[model samples]
Target: MAKRKGTVFGVPVVVALFFLGMMMPTSVGISLGGLRLSVYRVVLLVMFLPMLITLFSGRCGKPHLFDALALGHAALALVSLIHWGGLQQGLESGGIYIVEFAGAYLLGRLYIRSSEDFRALARAYVVTVVGMLAFTIPEALTSVHILHDGIAAVTGGAPAPYIDQRMGLERTFGPFDHPILYGVFSASAFSLAYFVLAEKRLTNGRGMALVLGVALATFLSASGGPYVVLMMQAFVAGWERVMGRLPTRWKLLWALFAVIYACIDLFSNRTPFHVFVTYFTFSTVSAYNRILLFEFGTAEVARHPWLGVGLGDWVRPVWMSDSMDNFWLLIAMRYGLPAWALLVGLMLGLVWAVGRRKGLPEPWKRARHAWAFTLFGITVAAATVHLWNALFVLFLFLIGSGAWLYDARLPKRIGQPPRLGPPAPRLRPPPERLF
Candidate 1:
């Protein structure tokens, strides 16, 4: 809690470095499309320097399940790269991929070892949401994206990459590649704000105001992606209230309702997947492209079931299909189905770990709800939008940190430390959990 330069080696400093790197701005920038290697990446590399030192000095511990999954995903990407892009190109691209995404997870796993440490990151996210508003609010009202202008000024790129007019208004993209992605980023930050600023946790009135401000900023982003994510968060909140606390008959009634809905979708020839396609059709171009990409990309993944195509290879199949906006399909098309499976397995595992109804304490239960919402938001947004570099890495970082928290709060026998490096005991008694 001490805000001083001398405390840079502690957990709080991790938050400092992350936000500094994220907000480093493109005024001193470089833009190679999504792979822009600019000051932000440079600062992340610097922030990562200490972790690299610790890791190489034999100070790190055994790999957690999520860590292993990340390593597997990285290795698979490398193999896919070598097959599709050649060994040299693979090394270059795959090296960057691993360093940015996998390295983020590694830092979280080794350094952010507890809920307190994770809160440091959450606090930084809440602050970044406010900082983003300084730019985004202007963009929304006056239709000027300052960060976009700065990127153009420094890198000689387009004035604003993904700006578009829809329904008589200009979509304000802020610092992200697209308007929806900006909304998704805001939505993610809003989830972090909920954890960092619970109702009674902050005495000042700013906590409530900040939460509302994030919600407004998210709404003003004028994109459906974040709206869907917000709905998911609301669903999680409502579910938390009645999920395990409900009587068996009430739970059965909800289950029957779900079954009836599924049956309706099936019999009416509107499958669940079709429901997503219909519900996510907020923008014609993005929705059409997503459907086209999903249809073509799935076939491509089937074609090359193991090591999939190079990043640019699938573009020749359909005109303007250069970007697979959905992250899961992107992975399946480029790396292979295995990578997708591994990534999804890790996320689902986190959801299950947190949703366990056993003697979950108040704090851990809240962590579970927040983390589940994080996973749900990420999953929903990834299906409609794409993020780049530091932003994308931040997604992977949360996945790792959530997994770590789930492991840290697992119930243990009296006098034993919380579970670590082992699977949850199948037959242990309901035990206490940490807040």
Candidate 2:
């Protein structure tokens, strides 16, 4: 078998473009005189499309499990478009989310061709996150400028005067449009960083220092839901390591802790230290909020059991009196039960594939393990926040990359060897002619 040659520029270029796309300022919209382009949409065009072309042109290999997952998402998007209405309404609103997710999956499939590529991508992610945190930490401590802007943006237009009066201290939002979102994004990144650092020995002191900075960022972000999700992921990882098994008294203990924590958070207005300790000591309010939102969303699902009340319409003012934070609810509201079912099946299938392919080689196996837990954390986190965004897309790339790494290691099916025969025996006459 021929060994694969690594491209000097391709992978790094893709990683850089992706990180830039995520970090680019959306406020300064891409513009040409009267016309303005969204940074995100442009990012999709510049980063993802060329990469797809490269993959197909290179005949990289057959599509792997993550490819299958993208197909499933795309299929669901297409179905929603056809059944619910045309592209403008269905695709533009609800369908766009799926498209972005598929884009992430495609990018992941294209860039992650080998275990080394997977590791490199992970390192890039860690670096990008740490950089963001480095900027945010100083901003968080010195002034409330970032938080004020985030609140204003999240509220849509200017925030109400009363909102400022009520909160007293300014909320800390970091770089994101909302504080909660900032927290969620930071938590996921921090958790992944932890996993990456833990898996490999950090021989380089600089790498270890960066990981520590990321951990601090996670702690300070203070978004309740993601923090809880990270804790849960840590517990799951620890449990997986200990006893070499899942399902035991420890699971029960964790569940009980979660329930108790939620009860306390809901009923009490404790001090910051108390809240922090209680939140971690038990299940927490974040979990309870998810349950409530999911319930509320399900009730709406019952109303429109078949086709949903149009994409984006469910969250509109007329549909419900309150916000629906749960991801399942969001899906059910946009695409109805059938689409929701397809999504669930896709996620479950991915989880099963990761679990079944546990014995794959290094970096690949480690990546798969990280992805499985990451996805689990994502699922839990999504119950309290939207998972269809640029950050989530970045995450999908990591997951798809892991799947591709696994596929790369698998033995090829039986096939005939190349038919080029040994060089024809050199004749004495030929040798004399050469002389």
Residue by residue across 78-174, what tens digits does model 1's lDDT show? 8888888788888878877777777676666666656556566566566667767787777777778777676666756567655566555567676
> What is candidate 2's lDDT per residue for 176-195, written digit by digit as tens?
54555555555555444555
TM-score of each: 0.80, 0.70
- Predicted structure with the largest lDDT when compared to the true one: 1
lDDT assessment of candidate 1: 0.67
lDDT of 1 at 338: 89
Candidate 2, number of clashes: 5
Which residue pairs in candidate 2 collide? 257-283, 258-283, 261-283, 261-284, 262-284
